[model samples]
Target: MMEKAYAKINLILDIVGKRPDGYHELKSLMIPIDFYDELYFEPSDQVELISNVDIHNNAILKTVQLIKDTYHIQRGVKITLNKRIPLGAGLAGGSADISATIRGLNRLWGLNLPNRALTQLANALGSDTLFCLYNQRAVIYGRGDQISILPPGKPIQNITLVCPNIPVLTKDVFGVFEKAVAHDFEIVYNTYLVTKKESLLYNDLLEPAFKVSPKLKDIYNHLVSLGLKPHLSGSGSTCFLFDLTEDQKNLLKNIDDVTIIDTQEHQ
Candidate 1:
């Protein structure tokens, strides 16, 4: 069985408040992009994973163990992952993998677990894993487990992403995060609703992410210098721009030392 795990970008990220449980309450718009990782599964006597990239403290392993214990399954499987998503770029690569594993194993083992069960498993794995299970454009709330699928609007097109080679830790960024005022969130949200302008979108985590890594701030300023308005995705290291012209796309290609990803290009 093969499963595709699509990476996600947070177009709008707002920090509502810090919960007592240490997880910050968030309201963000998250969408899965065309870029993805592939996982191939084969039945085996023991659970084993082979991947193109080395992920420390892999959540996929935990997900597999969770499913086995939850369903009381004695069977094991060997999984091979062709990882394409860039790690720690504020893209939910790990969460996507976890969700894919859940789905892949469900089909492989014929568990027939319902959506609710899958969601429960996802929620336990991480904040963004639940969102990956659906892979739709949605507004996520309350530490990212609560998902509200937005009414279908125009599809996002000409999406270009600039991912710096550095990795930014989400926990590190959140640790130093300063919550934005409720008024700021209201204005940004309302403005985007009315205009559908990418520039109107806001990320409360940007300042904290910059604080965690000054180099990210430097990159942001550099993009601005080139007359581009880039919005930070999720926490840090990756910034995205929408509706770029052909000239702007070429300009991005000339940028040194950054990975450029374009989405929704027509053949």
Candidate 2:
């Protein structure tokens, strides 16, 4: 069984409130994009896992072990992860890959789980896992598992992402949002809700994300300077410039450690 794990972007993200579980409540439009990591499940005689990236870091290996202990399943899956999405870039590459793995293994091992059951498994790994399971444009809330799929709306135009050769920890970016330093969420939310002639895109994580990683800020500002609507993907590091011109794509080729991925607005 092979699973293709996709990457997602938060077209608009707002930390609405703090949850009772010490996690912040959030509202965001999440869209899975073209970038993906491939997972191949090989059923073998022995229980084992392998990946090009570190096995300790591969979520498939770790989650499989967790499922094994919890379910006492008879079958085992040998996983091979081909990591393409950059790690720690606010892309949810890790979580998405894990979600894909869980989905793949369920079938390969003959678990015959329903979507809801798979989603329950997703929640055990991370709140964002459920979004990955759906792999469509959705409005996510309450720790990111409470997803409501939206009807097909305006298609997203072209966007280019530039990720500097550095990692931006998603947890650290969220910490900045919750700290006593204070930030404005109301203004951003107001901006997000306005339906427009074109697609409305915004990321509340931008200000604080750039604060920690100035290079990421540089990329964001650079895009804005060029009259492109720019937003940070997920938490930080990956900055997306929307509706680009041919010249912009040509210019993007000159940047270091950047990849141009075609993205769609999931509705």
Candidate 3:
């Protein structure tokens, strides 16, 4: 079976608090994108995993092991992965792939689990994994596990994502928020209302991220200079320009050493 794992972006994000478990509570409107990673699964006599990337912390293999350990099924499986989503871009690529694996393996093994059960398991893999299981626009809270179906709001603009070959640590991003704990619930909730208001919806992480990677500031400043208001996606590294026409897209294509991905709200 071949399955495609999609990417996600935080339309609006805020840090609510840090849980006792050390996980940060967040309020964010998350939307899935068409960017994907491919996974191929086949029934095997023994459980095994192989991948294109080295995968030192192999989520696919770990997911298979986790399912067996949790569900205690004696099924054999094999997974082959084709990774396209840029790593550490806050795009939830690994989580998406794991969700797809769970879905595909459940089907291949005749597990017949419901979406709710699958979501529960997805959470075990990662907080974002559950959203990928549902794979839709959602109001995300509680470590990204408490997901609520959002109103089918009017679609936003076409997006162009450019990852500046730098990895921004999500934990560090949340940690920064934890220490500061800006009481800007106004900024937090405005974006959730899903209107055309632009200013408050932007991420406050930009200041800290620019401090860490001046190159990120360089990329962001360039996008802004082009008359496009871009926001840092999730934690960092991947910045996006919204609502570009074909001519604008061609203009961005002229830039050197940029990874441009054409994206829209996943319908």
Give the candidate number with the greatest TM-score: 1
Name the regions of candidate 2 deviating beyond 4 angstroms.
153-157, 178-199, 265-267
In model 1, which residue pairs have backbone atoms overlapping below 3 Å?
none
lDDT of 2 by residue, 1-267 (tens): 799888888877777667788888888877787778898888876667767877355567778877777678777778888888888888888888889988887878888888888888898898778988878877888898798876545656565677667889877887787433333544543455455422455666777787788877777777677666667888878877667778877877766666666565534
Task: For candidate 3, list the clashing residue pairs, or say none.
Answer: none
Model 3, 1-267: lDDT tens per residue?
A: 898898888766676677899887777777888788999999898877777777668788888988888888887898889988878787888889999999888888888988778888898889789888877778788888888877767766577898777777776666566335464655555544655666656565667677767777888898788887888878877887777888877877766656899888886
The candidate with the higher TM-score, 1 or 2, is 1
Task: State each model's CA lDDT, in order.
Answer: 0.87, 0.76, 0.79
Comparing 2 with 3 on TM-score, the higher-scoring candidate is: 3
* Residue 265 accuracy (lDDT) in model 3: 80
Task: Provide the clashing-pair count of each candidate structure.
Answer: 0, 1, 0
Query: Which candidate leads in lDDT?
Result: 1
- Predicted structure 1: clash tally: 0
Flag regions of model 3 displaced more than 4 Å: 178-194
Provide C-alpha RMSD values for all models, in order: 2.1, 3.1, 2.3
Comparison by TM-score, 1 against 3, better one: 1
lDDT of 2: 0.76
